[model samples]
Target: MTGAAAGTASRPLLGSAVAALALAALTALVASGSDLVSAFDARFRAGADRAFGASAGSWLGPDGPADAVGSALLGAGLLTALGVLLYRRRPGAALWVLVGLTVQFAAETALETLVGRPMPLPADGSAPDPGYSFPSGHAASATLILMVLLAVLRTGTRVWWSCLALGSALVAAVGVSRVLADAHHAADVAGGVLLGLVVGCAVAWRVGVRSPHLSGKETR
Candidate 1:
């Protein structure tokens, strides 16, 4: 590859690697019970509860409206993208999306187990969700799936920009919902977003290299 081509290819890989390193560092810090992280979590949780109150939990909790809407949106987006890729005869791109999601979920599960961080109590003093919560699965899934969709539709068009805005909004909403539901610490959501970035960038790199047509890049 020419220098420019190589650089273009390396950018996504480099981003993925950096995100991976940051995620690892955050996981280690959380696992070690860092006082700084703990303090920050406490303060953030307090502030969120004060600002949103217990009522927010009813609408943002795991079984709430936000969760339902986010799930529906993600599912529809992925299915639609898969259909389009298949129709375009870019089965490789579709396959990569499935593979990326599998990897993202597996990574989150492993990290959650490794960190063993418990959920915080809700503002209403309700029972916390039972599970290890270091990296929020909801946040990670939203980030990864929506980001992949964004990349697939990123053609520098008005539609692409609209999708970008919608995807960004959904991701933010999902992350905040998890925090408001007391299902994760603010740091947990951050770690999840970072984890998603790692997987999303890696998938994008693979798709771009392996299927330039899908990535809208000229094949060399």
Candidate 2:
């Protein structure tokens, strides 16, 4: 490869490495309870506390209104449905989507275990969850799947930009829902975003590098 080609080829690897480092740093900050992180965590939790009490009368009715959107089952179901739908027409895309989701889930689980962060209780004094919480899994799930969809649906047109905007909105909604439900701290959601962005970018770069349709003639 020419020097320029070599540089282009290495870009994905560099991006993936940077993303992995960012996730590790976030995990360390959360685990060590560094003063700055701790202060931010406290303030973020306080904001959630205020929102929780204020939204009690809303349609979600205080017992986790956002449960349907952020639940693990729903996330899995959505991904599965997409995979099934795309399997026939785009087997590679379907397989890669599954691969991305698996990585996202496993990383979330491992980080939660390692960090051992606790979930905040619901405003109504519900029982504390037994599962570990650090990076919000719902946020991660929403982000990963949405990114996959965007890549698959991308057409190098104005419509592609629209999809990007829509995907971002959905991911943000998932994160906000988790906070309003008192299921995660703001830092936790932020970690999930970072984690998802890295994983999603890595997956997209890998796919782009491999597929002529994505990286060559169809390039945007």
Candidate 3:
């Protein structure tokens, strides 16, 4: 809150803003060329083999929760409640909700339609796809879930380090499972991770700045 401490803290914010701009620019540039886009589309289409590539991938990978009622229960019932309950701090909880919403939007709407990438298919050559594939929702939601959990638990839990370790591990495992299932590409997963980290950290930083107890304690 003081002059020197504030200056030290603002550096990370400045750096992150710069980095986000850079990534946005990079993603934009990659999307501008039709020839390149066509090439990529052709590759994915050609590379996708219904009987083997896509089918094998889907089978090998972890099952997705999009169609599963149980998953919705877990996310809506357990995760949402946990996010609110664990984060007794107002700023932190609000930040987490904003981050969660952002992750969900990027995964379900913006990224999905933007990429229009198809999933690995069955032996009958039927495609299992809703829309684009530039970013994976499963990976994004999984990351957001853990990120929220960590933020919610960070200030309250005595064992903050363990919470972080467990959260990160869970996110990574879920992402790997999604990939193995042929639900998403490695690039899509990476995009999801980056999106989650940026939004989650921004919320965390803003919350930490306002938290009296975490004024100097949070390294985020």
Best model number under TM-score:
1
lDDT (C-alpha, whole model) for all candidates: 0.74, 0.69, 0.52
In candidate 3, what are the lDDT values of residues 1-220, reduced to their tens digit?
7886576445435644654575465346334534554455445434444422553443443353322432343355335535554556464465455556665675457655664556644334456555555565655565555554544444555556776676666556555544445565545556566665555555555544555443555432
Q: What is the lDDT of candidate 2?
A: 0.69
TM per candidate: 0.81, 0.78, 0.62
Better of 1 and 3 by lDDT: 1
Model 2 agreement with the true structure over 20-72: per-residue lDDT tens digits: 78888989999997787768867875665576556454533226556565674
Off by over 4 Å in 3: 4-99, 102-108, 121-126, 148-158, 216-220
- Residues 73-147, candidate 1: write the lDDT tens digits: 557667766886777676887888789889999999899888889887655656788888889776777677665
Q: Pairs clashing in candidate 3?
A: 61-180, 61-181, 112-132, 116-132, 117-132
User: Model 1 misses residue 125 by how many Å?
Assistant: 2.5
Query: What TM-score should be assigned to candidate 1?
Result: 0.81
Score residue 180 of candidate 2 by CA lDDT.
68
